[model samples]
Target: MSTVLIVAEHLNGRLNAATARCVSAAAALSPAAIDIVVLAADAATIAAQAAQIAGVRKVLAVANPANAHAIAQVQAPQVAALAGGYSHVFGPSTTFGKDLMPAVAALLGVDQVSDLMAVEGSHSFKRPIYAGNAIITVEMPAGSQVVATVRTASWPEAAAGGSATVEAASVDATLPSHTRFIGLASASSDRPDLQSARRVVSGGRGVGSEDNFKIIYHLADRLGAAVGASRAAVDAGYVPSDLQVGQTGKIIAPELYIAVGISGAIQHLTGIKDAGTIVAINKDGDAPIFEIADIGLVGDLFQVLPELEQALG
Candidate 1:
């Protein structure tokens, strides 16, 4: 029977929902055991939270001061050290996992399978290519350890209720000195995080300018949703790159995704392909965004937004 180990992703002592989604992907393998390893300066809280994820058999807490920051180079060696006895190692295909999994694969001397969307067998999987326009099956050599990043957007978060045990783990890998946690500079926002939000409202270049983006934000706030932007909006300097959602930016699977003034480029559609309900609002009646949108409105956003906000009230 196969056994899987997942690297836990957490911040501020809280477990990331992506970790639970990884658990969902691992569950599809029907492995003998699914364990999570939490590497942190203090892993107790995170480990305890991970232990509650359904299908998890155990949580390994690796407490080390060097793990205070999520520097890929620093954590990859430790994860590689703990890979023994496991048939597969999984991580989420988020920015953190994208940065760390390749290094883990290098340390293990194996090719990393990325953005795994489906499990065909223990060693066979399916993933997207050509900006999610196509999916191809990949088979890992039998009997070889599999290191992969799970496509978080493709799997639902595993429910909590498990009473798995948490254990303290220690890895003796030689830590690299060349890389150190310098500092992190990120925008602070009261709004929900775009990647994990249940609902999102995104603006595009047609929103006019940065100042006009307030309409998008106001609508999003009224809906209690996160704010996102099309790559065109970011490129036009109407929003920051961090808020961009497309093939080149963040891939999200919100329950509700609203695209305002977006032309629905294939690249943008690729990111929201897994969204539950897509609503498009644009003046152009025949915009490509309407091709896949569940609901579309053909009107000027500047005039429609205030009325929509009032209707909500």
Candidate 2:
């Protein structure tokens, strides 16, 4: 039987939903145990939240002042030191995991599995390729510890009914001096986070100038949804690159995804293929976005948006 150790992803003293999604994937393995390791300056709050994830056996709280920030170089050695006695190490396939897991795999002398969507066996898994147009099964060598990133979009979050015990962990790894915490600059928004939001409203180049993006924001606010933008819109300077949703941007699986004035290029479609209900509003009736949209409205967004908002009320 395999023993799985999950790296908990948290920010602002709260656990990320992606960590619970990883728990869901770990549960599919039917492993001997599923434990979460929280590396933070003060892991008590995050560890408490992680313990509530159903199927988790225990939470390992490694409180270190060096872990105040999520610098992958500083944290990888600590995680590697704790990897002994575990058959598998898992992390979410997000920006943080992408940056950290590769280093862990390198330290473990194993190839890292990216975007694991399904578990075929203890050492075999399925993941997407070529912008999600293809899925390939990968098999790890027997007896080799598996290091993988779970695709949070493909798995539902584990429920919160567990009462797992939290244990303090002390890691003795040499910390590198090359990388040091400097600062983080991110746009502050009161809107829902696009990657985790259940409902999202996106705009494209057809939405016109940056000022016209207010229509997209208004509709998103009305629906209490997050705002996203197509790569074209980002490239056109209508919105920030952070809001881009496509192959080159964040992959999300919202229950409701509304694309306004988007033509639905394949790269853009790759991002939301797992979305439950896709609604597209485009002026061109033959727009490719309608091909996959559950609901499509063919009309000028300038005239259609106001009516939709009124109907929402």
Candidate 3:
């Protein structure tokens, strides 16, 4: 019977939603047992959350002061140590997993499968390549372990209400001293997190300036959607780089994605290709965003945005 282990991602004592999506991908492998490994300074809270994800057989909690910062050097060893006898080890395809999973694979002496989107078999899977323009299928080496990062946007989150047993893991790996936690410089916002939000509203360079971007936010607020921006908007200093959405930024698969003033560069389109429904608004009728939009509106965004906000209000 195949068993799978998912490296749970958490921050500030809260579990990330990506962990549940990783669990969904693991379930696709038809594993006989699925377990989650939680690493943090105080893992009890996150462990309690992990125990609630459906279909999880067990939760392995590793509470350590060194694991607080999510330093890959410390996390990878703990994950690798707990990976024994498991057929597959999974992590989410987020900034956290991107930085950490390869290290785990290296420690286990195996190749890491990047961005696993579909499970063809227990040992085979499909993933994207060339900035998501091409998809490739791969089969893991037989009898060797499969270490993969699940493309979280491609999988629905596993349902809650699981009754998994949580236990502390016994690990004796030497912690790395080369890394230390400093501080996080992040913008605090009441808006939903772009990667996990169900609806997203993005502004592009046509918004003119950072001040003008408020209109986009107004519309987003009315819709109760997460605010995002194109690379141009970010590069032009209208928004922080964290809010940028493109091939070089965050990939999202929201149920509704609305683009205002975006010309829809290929890089930008790559980020929203998985969206359930796309709505594009721009004066340029030929803007590339309209090409893929489920609903296209060619008009002045300056006037349209205010009107749209009022209508929603």
Candidate 4:
């Protein structure tokens, strides 16, 4: 039986939705046993949340004074060590997972799989290639334990109900040599995090001007959605870099994605292809954005937008 271990993520005791998705994916690889490791200053809180994630066989709580802030420098090696007995290790393709999992893989001398969408066989998987324009299935070199990061939107989160046993896992207090803790900076946003938002309204070059970009926000606010932008919109000075969605920017898996005036370059599409529903509004009906859209409106965006707001009202 192959043992699979999943790393749990939390912010101040609130379990991240991605952790449950990772567990759901890991369970497909092996149902023999699934251990979810929660590294935190407060074990009881993390453990409580871990118990709620479905398909988990056990919750391994590792409490440490250094984990109060839970930076990767200390958490990676600790998690790598605790996961020693497992044949496979998994984490969500989140900031923490992207930051920490490769280091853990390096410590364990195994190749790390980044942004896996589907597992084919025990060792073969299908993942996006060329900025998600193509899909490639590859096999991991045998004789090594699998270390993978799953894109949360690719897997549906399982419903919660498990008699998962909770165990206290131990870890070294010292930080790994290759990393260090740094001061934190905060971003201001009343909206949900870009990755977690369910409804996203994005603008592009057709937005015309920086002032016109406000329409994106107005629509988003009216719909209770997050605001996003194409690289063209950001590079053209219509929006901030943080709002950009593309190969180099944020990947979003919203329930509804509105692409206003975006040309649907492969890079931008890669970031939002997972969205449940896509609506494209572009003057050029021939724009590639229409290819993936569930609803494509061919009209001048300037004329269409205000009417949309009024119609929605």
Among all candidates shown, the one with the greatest lDDT? 1
User: Compared with the true structure, what per-residue lDDT tens digits does model 1 show for residues 1-313?
Assistant: 8999999999888899999999999999999999999999999999999999999999999999999999999999999999988999999999999999999999999999999999999999999999999999999999999999999999999999999999999999999999998889999898998999999999998999999999999999999999999999999999989999989999999999999999999999999999999999999999999999999999999999899999998
Local accuracy by lDDT, each model = 0.96, 0.95, 0.92, 0.85
- List model 2 lDDT by residue over 7-119, tens digit each: 99998998999999999999999999999999999999999999999999999999999999999999999999999989999999989999999999999999999999999
Task: Give all TM-scores, in the order shown.
Answer: 0.99, 0.99, 0.97, 0.92
**Candidate 4 per-residue C-alpha lDDT over 211-242 given as tens digits, one digit per residue, 9 for 90 to 100:** 99988888988998999999999999998888
Which is the winner by lDDT between candidate 3 and candidate 4?
A: 3
- What C-alpha lDDT, on a 0 to 100 scale, does residue 74 get in candidate 1? 94
TM-score of model 1 (CA atoms): 0.99
Query: Which segments of model 3 are wrong by more than 4 Å?
Result: none
Least well predicted 10-residue stretch by lDDT in candidate 3 = 304-313
Is candidate 2 or 3 superior in TM-score?
Answer: 2
Model 3, range 1-313, lDDT digits (tens) per residue? 6799999988767788899999999999888999999998788889999999999999999988788788898889888988987999999999999999999999999999999999999889999988889999998888889999999999999999998999987687877888778888888988888999999999999999999999989888888999999999999999999999989999899999999999999999989999999999999999999999999999999988888877875
Error of 1 at 27 (Å): 0.5
Q: What value of lDDT does candidate 3 attain over all alpha carbons? A: 0.92
TM-score quality measure for candidate 3: 0.97
lDDT of 2: 0.95
Candidate 2, pairs of clashing residues: none
